[model samples]
Each structure stands twice: as C-alpha cells, then as structure tokens.
Target: MKFGDIIVAMSIIAIVIIIIIPVPKSALDILLSFNISLALLILLISMYIEDSLQISIFPSLLLITTLFRLSLNISTTRYILSEADAGKVIEAFGEFVIRGNAVVGFIIFLIIVIIQFIVITKGAERVAEVAARFTLDAMPGKQMAIDADLNSGLISEEEARQRRKEIQREADFYGAMDGASKFVKGDAIASIVITIINIAAGFTIGIIINNMSFLEALNKYVLLTVGDGLVSQIPALLISTATGIVVTRAASDTNMGNDVLKQLFAYHRVMFIIGSVLLVLGLLTPLPNIPYIILSSSFFLIGYQIHSRLKISTEEEKEIAEEAEVEEVKSPENVMSLLKVEDIELEFGYGIIPLADANQGGDLLDRIVMIRRQIALELGIIVPMVRLRDNIQLNPNEYVVKIKGIEISKGEVLFDHYLAMNPGTAEGDIEGVETTEPAFGLPAKWITEEEREKAEVLGYTVVDPPSVISTHLTEIIKRHAHELLNRQDVKKLIDNVKEEHPALVDEVVPNVLSIGEIQKVLANLLKENISIRDMVTILETLADNAPITRDPDILTEHVRQSMSRYITKKYTQGNKINVITLDGELEQLIMESINQTETGTHLTLDPNTIQRILNSLSMNVEKFTSIGEQPIVLTAPIVRIYFKRITEHAIKDLIVLSYNELEPSVEIQSLGMVTLK
Candidate 1:
C-alpha cells in the first residue's frame, strides 16, 4: 500500500495495542496531547465544509477517534492504578488547570459529559436519523426526476448516472452518521465510568499496596483520577460537537463561515435595532458606565459600517445591470445571434415550462431524446437535436413545435392535472374540463390527480401533462420527418451504411445517383410513413433502376416496390389487408390524363373529374373511420403518387399504396371502389 495508508493502518493497530499493554508516561502524555489536537482539527474541518457529503468519511473517523480516546483512557488508568501516577499531562491538568482540587476537576468533567451526551450528541443523532429516513423515502422520487432529465435531453446519461451516485452517497452518509453518533454516546459513558472506577480503585491501591497514609492516598489518587477524566472528556466533548456540526450541515457552494456571515449579517436594519437596544440598556442599567459605553459604541459603529456597505453594494449591482443592457444594445452580435435557427425547436409557454425544466421535475428534455431515438429506429432517419425554449407571448398553457423556424404544430396542456380519454366504451360521462387530446385530436377531459385512479378503473386512459406534450412532439416530428431529411442527414445515413454495406453505398451513391437524388428518395419514403432502415434493399433497387430512368419520382416508386414486405406488414390486420380501390374506368381515365415530357410526367385531368374523384375518396375515408379502420387506397403504380398528392389535404390520414407495393403472401380484402357517378 501507499505510505499514508500504511501510516493509518499502523496507527489503528497501535490504538488496539495501547488498550492491551501499558505505555510509559512520556508516550502517554504525547498521545493524550495528539488526541486533543486531532479532535480540535476535526471540529475546525467540519466548520469549514459546505456539505455533509463532502466529508463522507466522517463516520469512520468518528469511530476511530472514539476508540483512540478510550484506549488512551485505559492506558492512563493502568499507569495510575499500578504506579500511583498517570503522566505529566494528567498531573499538569490536575495541579495547574484545576488548582489541585479533585472536586472541582470532577465537576468540570461531569459538566462536559452532560453537554456532550445529553445535548449535542442526542440532538445530532436524532437529526441524522431523520435525515437518513427522509433521504431514503425520497429516493424513488429523486430517481424518477433524474430519469426524466435524462430522457428530456437536459443532461446526458453519464451526468444522470453521476447525480444518482451522489444521491446514494448522501443517503449512505446520513445513515452511517446515525449509527456513528452512538459511538460518541457510548464513549462519553465509558469516560465517566472509567473515571469513577480509577478514583475508587486507585485509593485502595495507594493505601494497601503502596503503604501510603489516607490523606496522601486521597490527594494522590483523586488528583490522578480527576485529571485523567478531564483530559479524556475535553477531547470527547470537542468531537461530539464536531459530529453535530457535520451531520447538520446543508449542501451549498459556500462554506459554513461564508454562509454564517452572509445570512446572519444580510440585513443592516436588524443590526441597527440591536445597537439601539444596547444603547438604551446601557443608559438605564447601573452597570459600569465605561464598559457599557464601549460595548454600545462598538455595536453602533458596526451597524453603520454594514449599512454603508449594503448601500454601496446595491449601487454597484444597478450599475452592472445598466452596463449589461447597454452592451447588449450596442453589440451587433446580438442581432446576428437571432438570425441563426435551430433545426427542430419546442417552444412552450410559461405554464408549460415545468414540463421541460429538470429542476421543476419536468422530463420534457429527456422525453425529446427518447423521441429522437424512437424516430431513428422506426424511420431510419437521424432526427436533429430539438432545442427547447420558452416564449412568453403565447398563452400560459400553449406550446408550439417548430421545424426549421416554421411552426408545424401547436397544442395546450394543463400542468397540474391529467388528461382522461374514453377508450370508446365508458359507461358514463366523467366530470372534467372538456378538451381535445393534443396528440390525436381525440376528445379528452382535464381531470385532477385524485380522479386518475378512478378514471383508470372506469377504463378511461389517463395521461399526465408531460406525456401529452411529449406525445404531441413525437407525432409532429414523425409527420414532418421528410422535411428534416437534408443532404447532411443523407450523408450520415450513407456513412452508417458504409460500415456494413460499403459496396451497396458505392454502387448507388455518386455512381448511380448523387446525394440529392438519394435525399429525395429517402424523403419520399419518409413522407409515406415508410422506414428507410432497409438501406440495402433501397440502394440495390435504385442501382438497378437508375440506369433506365434518372427520375427521382420513378426511382422512389421502384424503391417502394422493393420494400413491399415492409409496407404490407404495416397495413396488414391479422391475416388480411382491407383496402379501397378505383374502378377500371377511373384508373383508365387517370392513366389517360398522364402527360409524359422531358421534364417529368404531368396530370392533365379535367377539374370536374378531379373533384368527383376527391369526393368519392373522402366518402370512403369517412366510412373506414366509422368502422375503426385506417383507410389504405390501392391503385396502379403509375397513379399512386398523383392520387396521394390530390387527396393529401382532403384526407390527412389516408394511405395510398400501389398494387406492386403489396406482398404476395398477404391477402388483399377490397372494401369498395371509388367510382364517379
């Protein structure tokens, strides 16, 4: 081991040896002095530490110090009983400090024991017990808060883990302190008992074995006994007081000394009142006039100094604030700073801040991180970091989700309540503030926490405010995932694919198609709620088809057909897929309207025909919704994109897929045909 570790181990071993063997008077004196010095050092260190956990080793230290003192007491008692003299340290305390009076020395030692045991040690033990209990009880809530922060992206996983470790250390420290306080109490009792035994037994030894007179025995033995008690009790008192200080310490950046001065002297008015009271007391009392005058004068002067310092400090703060404002206005960088925008941003009103703030126990940042990860896994698109900001201009309960500086979705949430939604089969209506679910626009009600369990029992889905906001954010990002897929994102996907499928990437990217072309295809897939995670299939399909047609639209269609199994699995319900299709005549009309040119294919259908087709599709979509089925329109490969474009605004949740995109293993169950009257 290291030198310091060796020294500590040897010292502890020596303490055990001291208990078993008698030490010489000189060695006893040195150890006694060291004991007092060490106790004082511990007290000073405890006073300076800002947090109790800063000195987490204090419990073990308390145990060691208590043992050391007890060992010294035993060693000194041996010498006093055997040789009728403990040491010079004990003799000096007996003769000079207590003036050779055994009764007075005994009384002083008793008083120290009472104070240490009855007052300081008892209070500290109780406080440590309560602290440990409360810390343990609050651990689950604290851990949940940490998880929320981790999910919200406010802190990284490593930071959250460190915070959790600190919390555990805090609980362990208090629990250890609770047990260690018993050591101090037991040591105090041992000191008192040892003193009584030494006095009683030493007198017998002095008279019977040493053949000394009764008066001589009384003087020699009692002095030695009382002296030993005072020596041991002084150090024990100091340590008990130190233990109290350590356990009661609060966590702060400032030390005990700074906190005392700042908090105790914060107000000059209190000092001034105290000074005035002292002045009045001095005038009315019959005590020594000069001493009173000096004391009162000192208070007045100190109060005035504090008042003047406070005034100067206030003025300096105002000056600093004004200077900051002036600098902010004068600097051109402040204006330029506003020009830069985050890729994805979540702006919440003042009331919704608690949902995002880690300090307030909101886990919105952590939820956003999870949302990003979920999107990346499901859509194969690495979502950009979502920046959370507060906007006071909006209503308190409102929040807006933005993409590339544009507001894509906005919603409202109640922070102190839960949202209860009927799972479509509730027996009766619940009393609550009616509102729409922000995520899906389904009818919901804001209910108090007390009603959450009841709502759950009634088969109503209950969600907290943070979950609501997070869900809304998740849905909005999924809907706009295509918009977030830029050239840089495409490059990242390519690099990631390069690790496992380097040849496939090389064949398609820069060789068959550029990054821009790939971005368009990926964006097209994302817009249709299709996962681009199957990059091998996507790239291979593009590599085969790009030679014949350099069109992104046609290339995307080809990629979709290759990913038929994936698309089909999503729309499939158990063994069959229910779908709406166009009649043969309607399909022919759409095909006839397609005008191929050098630029691309264009639809030249009449407005009346488009209107009739939209109306028919809308009716079918509504019919699917009433039956609780998502409407998926099956069409010819040439018209799927065109049909989707025409009906996107009219039917937001409509899914248009080409016949080529259907898996052969899945059976298609056609619901109806969308034919014009």
Candidate 2:
C-alpha cells in the first residue's frame, strides 16, 4: 500500500487505541480541537459538492468520524472521573459557558444533543432511507434510458457505459448512507450515557475516596462533565447537519451554495412580500419597533438591489444573444450547416414520444438496436445509425421514416390502443375502430386494452404502438438497404474481411475492381433481396468474372449464380418451389429485342407488348397471392435481368429469378405461363 493508505489505516488504529488507553490532557485537548475542525471541514465540503455521488465516500467517512468522536468521549470521561481534569478544551468550554451556573451549562448541552439527535440526525436518516429505496426502484428505468440513448445514437458506447457506472455508484452511495446514519444515532445515545456515568463516577471518587465535600465534588465534576458533553455534541451536531445536506442533495451542474442562492432569491417580489409582512408585524405587535424597523428596511434595500441586478443581467443576456445572431448571419459555414441532412431519421409526432421514452416503459430504442443487428445478419449490410427526434409539424398520431432527407414511408399509431390484425381463418368479428396496419397494408383495427384477450381469441395478431412503428421502420430500411450502402460501407466491410480473408481482399480490391464497383455489386444483390454475408464466395465469384465483364449488373448476376444455394433455400418451401414462367414465344421475342451497348444491355420491346406482359403477370401474381404463396417469376438466365427491370416498377413485391439461380435438388412447380393474347 501507498503511504497515504498506511497513514489512514494507522489513524483508525489510533482511534481504537484512544478508547482503551489513557491520554494526557494536552493530547486530549489537541484531539478534541481536531475533531471539531474535521466536522466543520466535512460540512463545508458537502455544501460545495454539486452531486451526492461526487462525495460517495461520505458514508464511510461518517462512520469513521462518529467512531473518532466516541473514542474521544470515552477518553475524556476516563480522565474526568479519575484525575478531575479531562482536558483544557473541555475545561475552557465549561468555564466559558457555566461560569458559576452548572444548571445552565447542562441545559445547553441537552439542547445541542436534542437538536442533533431529534432534528438533524433523524431527518438525515429518513432522507437516506427514502433515497436508497427510490434509487433501487428507479434503477431499471434508468438503465433502460441509457440503453435507449445508446440505440438512438444520442450517446456513444463509452458514454453509455459511464452513465451506467454512475447510476450503480449512486445506488450504492445512498444505501451506505442509510446504514451509516445508524452510527450517528448510536453515537448520540452513547454520548448521553457516557456523560451521565462521568458525573456519577466522579462524584463518588471525589467525595467518598478523596475526602472532598459533596458540593465541591459536584462543582468540579459537573462542570467537567458538561464541558466534555458540549465539546462532543457541538461537533456531532455539525457532522449530522453535513450528513443531511449530502443525502438531500440533487444532481446539478451547480454546487449547493449557488443552487440555494439562485432558487431562494430568484424573484425579488418574494423579498418585497417578506418586507411588507415584517412591517405589518412591527406596526401591530407589542414587541420593540426598532429591531423590526431595521429588519424591514434591510429587506426592502436587498429586494431593490436584487431587482436591479436581475434587470442588468437580462439586458446583458439580450446583448449577448444579439451579438450571436449577428455572428451567425455573417458566417458562411453556419448558413451551409442548414443544408446538411441525416442518413436515416425517424421523426415522430408529440403523441408518439411516450413510446420512445424509457421512463414510460418504451423499448423502441432497444428495438432499433435489434433491427440494425437483424438487418446486418439478414442482408449483410451495416445500417447507418438511426436518429430519432420529435417533430411537432406532423400530426400527433403520425410518424415519418426518412432516408437522405426524403420521406420513404409514413404511418400513424394510436398510443393507448393495440393494432389487432385479423388472421384469414379467424372465426368471429370483434368490435374495434377499423384501421390499416402500418407495417403491412393489412386490414387491422385499433382496440382497447380490455379487448386484447377477446381479439386474441378471434385469432388476431395484437401489436402495441411501439412495435407497429418499429416494424414499419425495419421493413422500410430493408427495402432501401441498397440506397443506404455507400463506398465507405464497402471499405468497412473489406477491412473486416481482411482479418479473415486477407489475401482475397488484397488481390481483388484495386487490382481488378474498385470499391465503387464492389459497392454497386453489393447494392445489386441487396436490390434483389440477396444477403451478401457470404463475402468470401461473392469476392471469389467477382474475381473469376471480372476478366469476362466489367459491368456491375453482369458481375452481380455471376455472384447470384454462385450463391444460388443460399438464394434457393430462402424462397424454397420443402422440396417444391412454385413459379410463373414466360412462354417460349414471348421468351424468344424478348431475346430478339435485347440490345447491347457500350454502357450496358437494353430491352427494346414495344410498349404494347410490355403492357400485355405486365397484365398477364399481374393476373398470375394475384392468383398466387390468393393461394398464400409468394409469386416468383422464373425465366431463362439470359433474359432474367431484362425481365426484372421491365416488371419492377409495375410489380412492387415481385420476385424474378433466373433458372441458373435455383438449387439442383429443388423441384420447380410451374403454376402458370405468361402469354400475350
């Protein structure tokens, strides 16, 4: 241990020694003065600390100081009964107060004890108990708030960790204080017992053993006992007051001193009212008018001074604000700052804030973190951090999800109601406000809490407001995953891959294709709902095909075929894959219309033919949807890209796959053939 630790340990040992060993009067006087000084110092420090956690060591300190005071009381009591002199400190206190009246001195000592035990110590103990209970109770909510901030990207991981530590420390501190207050109470009772014993024992020893008279013994012993009690009780009172201050303190940037002044004197009118009350009392009461007159005049003067200072402070603040405005107008950077946009933002109206607030039992932030992880696992894309904020301009029940400053999807949720979606096979109709599900365009209803069990009995999927919004956000992000990917994201992916596949990345990147080209390939795969998580296979496929074609579209097709097993497993059900195919005549016509250029390939099919193809595809897709099967259009490998491009705008959720992208073990169940009449 360091020297400081050694000193603290030795000091505690000394306090224990003081209880068992006799001390000289001079030494006792020095220790008594030191004890008083220590208590005063602690009180001053407590007043200056902004937060109770900042002085977390106070509970332990309280225990040590209490022990120290008790040890001194014991040592002084020993000398008073045996030697008739406790210390100069005690003797001086007795002489200063008792003069010749021991009764007055005893009463004063009793008053100090009563104040410390009944008022300060009791109040502090109560506050500490309440604080500890509430701190423990609020721990879960506080932890959730930290997690929420972390998920919302409002605080970094390090900050979140620090905040969590602070919360735990606060709980521990308050709990310690709750136990430590007992030590003070015990010390108070001990002092009273020790003082009584000192007086009784000293009187017996002096009158019976030393041959002194009863009155003389009483005069000497009573004065010494009262002095010793006064000396101990005064410091005890100070320490108790300090304990109260520390436990009752709130977290703030300002210390207790400044906070008290600011809150107490914030309004000058309070002082004015006090002055008026004092003036009225002085006029009506029978007490001396001079003291009240002086007090009221002081109050009026202080009030005027405070009012003037407030006015000056306001004017200075206005001047500073005006200067800031002028500076902001002149700065070009400030003007340009307005044009900056967030990558992804979730803007909710006022009514939806409670769903995001952790204190109100909202887990939206935690859900957002899960959504990001889910996207990364499903699509192999590290989604940008989503920023959540409140926007009053939108309707109270509405929320908008935006990407790159443009709105992608918007939805409304009733905060107090659950969205109950009817499963197709549900038996009975339930009473609720009819509405459309925000995440999917499914028919749903907003039902009250009491109707939740009834809705479930009817085979409805019940979801809360936060779940509805989060589900919609997750889907929106998945659909726009390609748009969210940038060259930076590709670079990060490559860096991550370098750890495991170093040689693969070093050879392919900047050797055959640039990061931008790789980004395009990833985007292309994401656009088709393909997970690029198998980076090694994708890179190897690109390495093999880069020499054959520099086009990203063609490269993506090559990667897709390589990942055919992964793709087929995702959409395949058991051994059968339901599919829609193009007729041989239509396929031949599409092949003839394909044109290759320096930029890329293009399909030159007539608009009428495209319309006819779309109508037929739509009919088949609807038939597949009605049967609860997702429609996948199967086409020849050569025309797959062209066919997907032609139908993408007209069919939102259509899945177009080439024959080469299917697994060999899978059986293709042809549902229908698309042919123009």
Candidate 3:
C-alpha cells in the first residue's frame, strides 16, 4: 500500500482504539485534535505562500489524516478561505480526493477549520485567565488604595478600604476561576455556533445558485456530490464520523449564538447575496463579459463613500465603545500620586495630597499617628510614615510608599501606578522601572539593586522613582497589628476556639508568632493539619508580620512575604485540589484559621468563622478548589491570600471548613526566611 494510504489506515486504527478502551480519553482527544490541527496548519501555510508541489505533498498527508480522522467540518471549511486554499489546489491538480466532490470536500474542510479555531480560542482563554488572575490581584490592590477615598463615609474609610479589599480579595479569588469558565461558555461556544451557521448557510446558498435555470454551464464547472472523491482515496470515507464529532464538539458552544445574528445582519449574508446575484448575472448575459475587478472596485468605492461621507457611528460602535469603557473602569489604575507639601512631599496611593494640607509641622510621633489615622479613615487602610534611618531618595520626584498597599484619601495626589519620567532619565539614572508613557498612567520607576534579584525570583518590576512613600511597612504592621489584635472577628475566633477547645489556648493563641512562623503555619495547613489551634497561631503571626505601619523597609518586606505565601498546589495525584489562591487577605485567613489550632489538643473553629470566611470568599470564585488545566505559580503573596480560603469552601453546594485544614505540617512552609527583608 502507498504511504498515504498506510497513514490513512493507521489514523483509522488509532481512532478505533481510542473508542474501544477509552482509558485516557481526554488526553487522547487532545492528541487526536492536536494532530489534525497541526496538519491543517501546515497546509494553510503552504497554500498561503504558493509553495511548490514538493511542499504540497505534506498538505495532502495532513489533509488525508484530518479527513480520515474527520476532525473538521467540510462546509465551514469551504467559506473561510479563497480559492488558493491548499484543499482547492488538490482539486486543481486532481492528485487525490477521498470524499470527492465540492459539497462533501467543503464539509470536511469546514470541520477541520472549525476545529482549528476552537483550539486557538481554547488556548487563548486559558493563558488569559492565568494572566488575569495575576493582573486582578495586582490591579485591585492598587485600587483598594484609591477606593478608600471614594467611600463617602458609609463605612470608616479604613473600613471601606478593608471592605473593598475584602470585596476584591473575593473578586480576584474568583475572577481567576471565572475566566476559565468563560472560555468554555464564551469562546469555545462562539466557534461552534459560528461554524454551524456558516455551513448551513453555505449549503443553502450553494444549492439555490445551482438550481437557478440560467446556471447550467456554471453548475457543470462547480462540483457537488457526497460520495466518490477525487483519486478514489478510500481511507477517509471510513472514519469521517469520528472526525466530525471531534471538530463539531470542539467548536460548538452557545456563546456564538449572537454572532450568527451579526453575520446575518452584516457582511456574510450580504456577501452571499452579492455572489448569487453576480453568478446569475454572469449566466444570463449574452455577451458574457462582466469584469470582476470593475464589480469589486465599484462595490468597494460605494462602501467607502457610504462609510466615510456619513461620518456617523451606528449602534455597534456605541456598544463597542461602551464595552471598552466598562473594561477600563473595571481595571484598577496602578499608579500612586505624590503630594507636595511645604515640609516634605511623598507619593501616596492613587491621588495626591499635600502633607501641609493635612498639617505638616506636627510632633513627629503625632504626625505619624495622624497620617496613619487619616490614611485608614480616608483610604480604609492604614499608611505608615516611618522615618527611614537612611532616607530612601526622593530625587526631586520619585518613591512609592507601598506599605503592603497604600490607602489614600480624597486629596488630589496625582501619582498613578502608571507614570512616565517626562524627560528621559539622565543616562546614569536609567536604572529604574521606566515608563512608556505617563498620560495614561504608566510611570517610570528605576529598578533598585535589591529589587532586581527579587524581580528575577518573582515577576515584579524593581524600578525606583523620585518620590517618598508616606507610610512605611513597620507602621502599617504596628497599626494593623493593633486593629487586628483588637478586631472583633479575631477576638471572636480566638475566644471561641479557646472556649470550644481549651487546650489550644496556649499552643495556638499565646501572644503572637512572627511573620516567619506564620509562613510555617500556612505551609502546614495546606499539608492538611488544620485545626483551631493552628489558625490562632496564623492570626497572631499575620498580625505580627503585617508590616509595622511606620516602617518603610518593613512595608516592602510585607509584600514579598505575602507573595511568597500564596498557596500553589499541583494536582498530579488524581485531580487533587488546585488553589487559584486569593491575594494576601484570603491566605491570611487560612493561616489565621490553622495557626489557631493547638498541638496535642482537640480543635474546631466556630461555624461563624467558617461562614464569615466563606461569605468573604464567595464574592470571587477563584477562592476555592481549582478546576482547570493551568500551570500554577505558587508565590508567597498568592499563597498568603488563598491558603486561608480553604476553610470557607463549599462541599457539594454546602459550606464547610475543609477538613484538610487540620492535618500535618498542614503548616507547609516551603521556605525559611534566611534573612528578613
């Protein structure tokens, strides 16, 4: 048998084997689909370049395999490309055709093309979802700083900031997961429906044109039959059914239902009608000499004039613009605005405000306290104002006072997450994170020597800027430490755990554990050693490690700490739980829960703890079990955020603290802080 025929037979045998046992169905499906896709990819490339016959041989093999595998729809394939498409070349040359004739060939072509589109959409969504998860956490953290200002005292701005974070923490947690959901529902579905409509439409139009009485000569030129393909290639005929299923299923989703309407209303339907008219005109004319270029140019000129002279936008543009604005509004602006004051100027979160406006010359400690309180009340979170022993340079314009995150009030500080150093930096000073443009919010910050090593390990930009941050990490931790120490929930979780499981009081709730210890406790919790005692320990640790509100270096350290702590677990062992971890708050919650558990004692958190955490988490779907095919990056911030969310997970639609919260070094601390940041 010829190699092409042998390949065809082998392809058929593989499909049959897959159907018979079905042991690794998903893997098999992916492989089968992927192979067909690759084959079609080669064919399209060759045809696009007008490759020689030598190169065309590969397209045949690929086309044959795909046809035999039935991985593409035959008709949708007909519509996507022009006559130069590789499949058409096979017709021109008459080398081989398995399911001979225009109709069947096009149908198979549609299946392959549709399958390719589905794969592309699927891959794009998966990558985007992952990128979105990261961007969501980073962006909202910036917004939490800004959002604190917009709250009209409905809650204490600090409360607003915290609440906003709570909301974002949930959103980011879930957005990560939701992106994947949309891929299945949105992108994949659009492909399927688009394919089906195009195919049905193509056949209907094709038949009608063939039947028109004036088209007898044209009908002879156009091939249309379901059986007896060119060259009598037999192998493809046997397995067309399976290929049809794969291509159809892969491309199909309900999301494309709307697109069908769009096609009908706009380009496709018009094109079909135009083509039919021209075909009829061509057949009816006795002179039989209608130039295609004249027709095309005339149509083009008419379209351009209509489109240009009107200078009017239809509902579509309005809808698209509205959608774009919505997206922009939804994404958080990442720049921090620096406020200029008589005594000192500093970069704050979102908008800028002068320290002078807030009262510049005050007792040092009192000024720090005022800044802290104002930051919390205005931004719904605290900002630390640490007097760095060694002043971090402000360079007449740059520095970010990022205390875990910054919370600014409504004052007009205009530094944004995105900024540009207007005049390109002096050559010597090009060492920071440079901005492409500042008008839209991208800013130029110089990469610091320390941040370079850090950026390498965790994908963070290590650029420096010319502004001072109002709050330092130490002050933030100190302030939050106090609030968290005194938070009603923390108090409640502690007291409840102590009361319900007395032995844990000492093992879990004694004083506070350092950030390092909290890290350990979190790692252990993920290992499944969750208990009330462990949770208390984590809370105390988080409270301790939450950067001191007045220490700059401490604040920077906190972000690093948090990122390092995000929970990332791979599910190689039988679809185990994959944590699309939340930012820091959620992870803090998990650590808090586990840290509360005691060694050598019975442990249980009140149902309220579970419920509150669950409620806080439900706003975003990324908080719980991971159900996707994605590679996870388990960084500290991500872990510190999502680890705590494990407790709030719903089991079969009912919420319960996951039992895994109480097992071994359930406290899995992957790293030891060799040196404190």
Candidate 1 local lDDT, 1-677, one digit each (tens): 65999899999999999999888889899999999999999999999987888788999999999999999999989889988888899988877555766667667767867887899878888888888898899999888777666554568767998999999998898889889988988998888789789978988888888999887888887788778887888888888888988877876788889999888877777877887777777788886667767777777787788899989999999999999999999999999989997678888899998777778877677777688789889999988777788999989999998899999889988889999999888766677899999888999999998888888888899999889988888898899999999999899888988999988898888988999989989999999889998888888999999999988888989999998888888778775889999988988888888888998778888888889999898888888889998888999998888888778887786799999998877888888789976
Clash-forming residue pairs, model 1: 151-366, 151-367, 152-365, 152-366, 152-367, 153-365, 153-366
lDDT of candidate 2 at residue 239, scale 0 to 100: 92
For model 3, residues 12-74, the per-residue Cα lDDT tens digits are: 676555434432334533543454455456434433332122232332343445443332323
lDDT of each: 0.86, 0.90, 0.37
**Prediction RMSDs, each to the true structure:** 7.9, 7.0, 24.5
Where is the poorest 10-residue window by lDDT in model 3?
A: 668-677
Q: Provide TM-scores for the models.
A: 0.68, 0.70, 0.23
Candidate 1 wrongly placed segments (more than 4 Å): 137-165, 330-340, 343-399, 411-471, 480-677
Model 2, span 387-498: residue lDDT tens:
9989999999899999999998999999899999977877798888998987789999999999999989888899998899989999998899999999998998988989
Ranking by lDDT: 2, 1, 3
Clashes of 2: 0
The alpha-carbon deviation from the true structure for residue 349 of candidate 3, after best TM-score superposition, in angstroms, is 11
